[model samples]
Target: MATQNARKQDPQEALIDDLRDVLADTEAMIDDVTAQGGEKALALRGKIADNLRAVRSRLYDAEQKVAGKAKEAARATDTYVHDHPWQSVGVAAGVGFLLGLLVSRR
Candidate 1:
Protein backbone atom coordinates (compact mmCIF):
# COMPACT_ATOMS: atom_id res chain seq x y z
CA MET A 1 0.00 0.00 0.00
CA ALA A 2 2.81 2.39 0.81
CA THR A 3 4.54 1.54 -2.47
CA GLN A 4 1.34 2.09 -4.40
CA ASN A 5 0.80 5.45 -2.71
CA ALA A 6 4.37 6.48 -3.49
CA ARG A 7 3.91 5.45 -7.11
CA LYS A 8 0.76 7.57 -7.29
CA GLN A 9 2.45 10.69 -5.91
CA ASP A 10 2.07 13.83 -8.04
CA PRO A 11 4.99 14.89 -10.23
CA GLN A 12 4.82 18.46 -8.87
CA GLU A 13 5.00 17.12 -5.30
CA ALA A 14 8.04 15.03 -6.20
CA LEU A 15 9.74 18.06 -7.74
CA ILE A 16 9.04 20.08 -4.59
CA ASP A 17 10.53 17.29 -2.44
CA ASP A 18 13.66 17.23 -4.61
CA LEU A 19 14.00 21.02 -4.42
CA ARG A 20 13.63 20.89 -0.61
CA ASP A 21 16.39 18.28 -0.39
CA VAL A 22 18.70 20.41 -2.55
CA LEU A 23 17.97 23.49 -0.41
CA ALA A 24 18.70 21.56 2.82
CA ASP A 25 22.01 20.25 1.44
CA THR A 26 22.99 23.73 0.24
CA GLU A 27 22.22 25.20 3.66
CA ALA A 28 24.34 22.51 5.37
CA MET A 29 27.25 23.16 2.99
CA ILE A 30 27.04 26.92 3.60
CA ASP A 31 27.05 26.34 7.36
CA ASP A 32 30.11 24.10 7.13
CA VAL A 33 31.95 26.60 4.93
CA THR A 34 31.13 29.42 7.34
CA ALA A 35 32.59 27.41 10.22
CA GLN A 36 35.83 26.80 8.24
CA GLY A 37 36.26 30.58 7.47
CA GLY A 38 38.87 30.96 4.71
CA GLU A 39 39.45 32.52 1.25
CA LYS A 40 38.66 29.18 -0.41
CA ALA A 41 35.40 29.00 1.48
CA LEU A 42 34.55 32.49 0.26
CA ALA A 43 35.27 31.44 -3.33
CA LEU A 44 33.17 28.28 -2.94
CA ARG A 45 30.34 30.35 -1.49
CA GLY A 46 30.52 32.72 -4.44
CA LYS A 47 30.34 29.80 -6.85
CA ILE A 48 27.41 28.29 -5.02
CA ALA A 49 25.60 31.67 -5.04
CA ASP A 50 26.14 32.01 -8.81
CA ASN A 51 24.89 28.49 -9.42
CA LEU A 52 21.79 29.15 -7.30
CA ARG A 53 21.07 32.36 -9.22
CA ALA A 54 21.34 30.49 -12.50
CA VAL A 55 19.02 27.77 -11.25
CA ARG A 56 16.52 30.39 -10.07
CA SER A 57 16.61 32.12 -13.46
CA ARG A 58 16.04 28.86 -15.29
CA LEU A 59 13.14 27.99 -13.03
CA TYR A 60 11.56 31.40 -13.71
CA ASP A 61 11.91 30.90 -17.46
CA ALA A 62 10.37 27.44 -17.21
CA GLU A 63 7.47 28.83 -15.15
CA GLN A 64 6.81 31.57 -17.71
CA LYS A 65 6.88 29.13 -20.60
CA VAL A 66 4.49 26.77 -18.84
CA ALA A 67 2.09 29.61 -17.94
CA GLY A 68 2.15 30.93 -21.51
CA LYS A 69 1.42 27.50 -22.93
CA ALA A 70 -1.39 26.95 -20.43
CA LYS A 71 -2.93 30.31 -21.37
CA GLU A 72 -2.71 29.47 -25.07
CA ALA A 73 -4.32 26.09 -24.47
CA ALA A 74 -7.10 27.66 -22.42
CA ARG A 75 -7.80 30.21 -25.15
CA ALA A 76 -7.94 27.50 -27.79
CA THR A 77 -10.22 25.33 -25.68
CA ASP A 78 -12.50 28.28 -24.96
CA THR A 79 -12.78 29.07 -28.66
CA TYR A 80 -13.51 25.46 -29.50
CA VAL A 81 -16.18 25.13 -26.84
CA HIS A 82 -17.83 28.37 -27.94
CA ASP A 83 -17.77 27.27 -31.56
CA HIS A 84 -19.30 23.89 -30.76
CA PRO A 85 -21.10 23.95 -27.47
CA TRP A 86 -23.21 20.85 -28.10
CA GLN A 87 -20.18 18.84 -29.15
CA SER A 88 -18.27 20.02 -26.07
CA VAL A 89 -21.18 19.07 -23.82
CA GLY A 90 -21.44 15.65 -25.41
CA VAL A 91 -17.74 15.03 -24.99
CA ALA A 92 -17.82 16.19 -21.36
CA ALA A 93 -20.79 13.96 -20.55
CA GLY A 94 -19.17 10.97 -22.20
CA VAL A 95 -15.95 11.56 -20.29
CA GLY A 96 -17.84 11.94 -16.99
CA PHE A 97 -19.79 8.73 -17.59
CA LEU A 98 -16.61 6.84 -18.42
CA LEU A 99 -14.93 8.21 -15.31
CA GLY A 100 -17.89 7.21 -13.16
CA LEU A 101 -17.78 3.67 -14.52
CA LEU A 102 -14.04 3.45 -13.95
CA VAL A 103 -14.36 4.73 -10.37
CA SER A 104 -17.20 2.34 -9.62
CA ARG A 105 -15.13 -0.58 -10.82
CA ARG A 106 -12.17 0.49 -8.73
Candidate 2:
Protein backbone atom coordinates (compact mmCIF):
# COMPACT_ATOMS: atom_id res chain seq x y z
CA MET A 1 0.00 0.00 0.00
CA ALA A 2 2.77 2.40 0.92
CA THR A 3 4.69 1.65 -2.26
CA GLN A 4 1.51 2.12 -4.34
CA ASN A 5 0.91 5.52 -2.76
CA ALA A 6 4.50 6.53 -3.43
CA ARG A 7 4.19 5.52 -7.06
CA LYS A 8 0.96 7.51 -7.39
CA GLN A 9 2.49 10.80 -6.27
CA ASP A 10 1.76 13.80 -8.51
CA PRO A 11 4.41 15.08 -10.90
CA GLN A 12 4.62 18.29 -8.89
CA GLU A 13 5.51 16.33 -5.79
CA ALA A 14 8.31 14.60 -7.71
CA LEU A 15 9.60 17.93 -8.97
CA ILE A 16 9.62 19.42 -5.48
CA ASP A 17 11.46 16.38 -4.12
CA ASP A 18 14.14 16.71 -6.82
CA LEU A 19 14.50 20.44 -6.20
CA ARG A 20 14.90 19.83 -2.47
CA ASP A 21 17.77 17.41 -3.21
CA VAL A 22 19.42 19.99 -5.45
CA LEU A 23 19.05 22.69 -2.77
CA ALA A 24 20.61 20.43 -0.17
CA ASP A 25 23.55 19.69 -2.47
CA THR A 26 24.05 23.41 -3.15
CA GLU A 27 24.08 24.19 0.56
CA ALA A 28 26.70 21.50 1.15
CA MET A 29 28.85 22.90 -1.64
CA ILE A 30 28.56 26.38 -0.16
CA ASP A 31 29.73 25.03 3.19
CA ASP A 32 32.72 23.33 1.59
CA VAL A 33 33.64 26.47 -0.34
CA THR A 34 33.55 28.55 2.84
CA ALA A 35 36.72 26.79 4.07
CA GLN A 36 38.74 28.13 1.12
CA GLY A 37 39.81 31.73 1.62
CA GLY A 38 40.35 33.57 -1.67
CA GLU A 39 38.79 36.29 -3.86
CA LYS A 40 37.87 33.70 -6.52
CA ALA A 41 36.04 31.54 -4.00
CA LEU A 42 34.10 34.55 -2.80
CA ALA A 43 33.08 35.36 -6.37
CA LEU A 44 32.06 31.78 -6.98
CA ARG A 45 30.01 31.76 -3.79
CA GLY A 46 28.22 34.92 -4.91
CA LYS A 47 27.38 33.34 -8.25
CA ILE A 48 26.09 30.22 -6.55
CA ALA A 49 23.92 32.32 -4.24
CA ASP A 50 22.38 34.07 -7.24
CA ASN A 51 21.66 30.74 -8.93
CA LEU A 52 20.09 29.39 -5.72
CA ARG A 53 17.78 32.38 -5.52
CA ALA A 54 16.69 31.90 -9.14
CA VAL A 55 16.01 28.21 -8.61
CA ARG A 56 14.01 28.98 -5.46
CA SER A 57 11.87 31.49 -7.35
CA ARG A 58 11.23 29.00 -10.14
CA LEU A 59 10.30 26.27 -7.67
CA TYR A 60 7.82 28.58 -5.97
CA ASP A 61 6.20 29.46 -9.29
CA ALA A 62 5.94 25.81 -10.30
CA GLU A 63 4.33 24.91 -6.96
CA GLN A 64 1.73 27.64 -7.41
CA LYS A 65 0.96 26.55 -10.98
CA VAL A 66 0.54 22.93 -9.93
CA ALA A 67 -1.72 23.91 -7.05
CA GLY A 68 -3.85 26.02 -9.35
CA LYS A 69 -4.21 23.20 -11.85
CA ALA A 70 -5.14 20.71 -9.14
CA LYS A 71 -7.79 23.05 -7.78
CA GLU A 72 -9.18 23.61 -11.26
CA ALA A 73 -9.38 19.89 -11.94
CA ALA A 74 -11.11 19.26 -8.61
CA ARG A 75 -13.62 22.00 -9.31
CA ALA A 76 -14.38 20.59 -12.74
CA THR A 77 -14.87 17.09 -11.34
CA ASP A 78 -17.14 18.40 -8.61
CA THR A 79 -19.26 20.29 -11.12
CA TYR A 80 -19.53 17.27 -13.37
CA VAL A 81 -20.58 14.90 -10.62
CA HIS A 82 -23.11 17.39 -9.30
CA ASP A 83 -24.56 17.93 -12.76
CA HIS A 84 -24.73 14.22 -13.62
CA PRO A 85 -24.78 12.18 -10.47
CA TRP A 86 -26.12 9.02 -12.13
CA GLN A 87 -23.61 9.13 -14.95
CA SER A 88 -20.78 9.64 -12.49
CA VAL A 89 -21.92 6.64 -10.45
CA GLY A 90 -22.18 4.50 -13.58
CA VAL A 91 -18.70 5.48 -14.66
CA ALA A 92 -17.31 4.76 -11.18
CA ALA A 93 -18.95 1.31 -11.20
CA GLY A 94 -17.54 0.51 -14.62
CA VAL A 95 -14.04 1.54 -13.52
CA GLY A 96 -14.31 -0.57 -10.35
CA PHE A 97 -15.46 -3.56 -12.37
CA LEU A 98 -12.56 -3.21 -14.74
CA LEU A 99 -10.09 -2.91 -11.86
CA GLY A 100 -11.55 -6.01 -10.18
CA LEU A 101 -11.24 -8.00 -13.37
CA LEU A 102 -7.59 -6.98 -13.80
CA VAL A 103 -6.76 -7.81 -10.19
CA SER A 104 -8.46 -11.19 -10.41
CA ARG A 105 -6.38 -12.04 -13.48
CA ARG A 106 -3.25 -11.71 -11.31
Winner by lDDT = 2
Give me the candidate number with maximum TM-score: 2
**Per-prediction count of colliding residue pairs?**
0, 0
Off by over 4 Å in 1: 1-24
Model 1: per-residue Cα lDDT at residue 39: 97
Let me know the TM-score candidate 2 reaches against the reference structure: 0.82
Model 1: per-residue Cα lDDT at residue 106: 81
Q: Give the per-residue lDDT digits (tens) of candidate 2, residues 1-49.
A: 6346447888677777678779889988987897886998889899999
Worst 10 residues of 1 by lDDT: 11-20
Question: Which residue ranges in model 2 land beyond 4 Å of their true spot?
Answer: 1-14
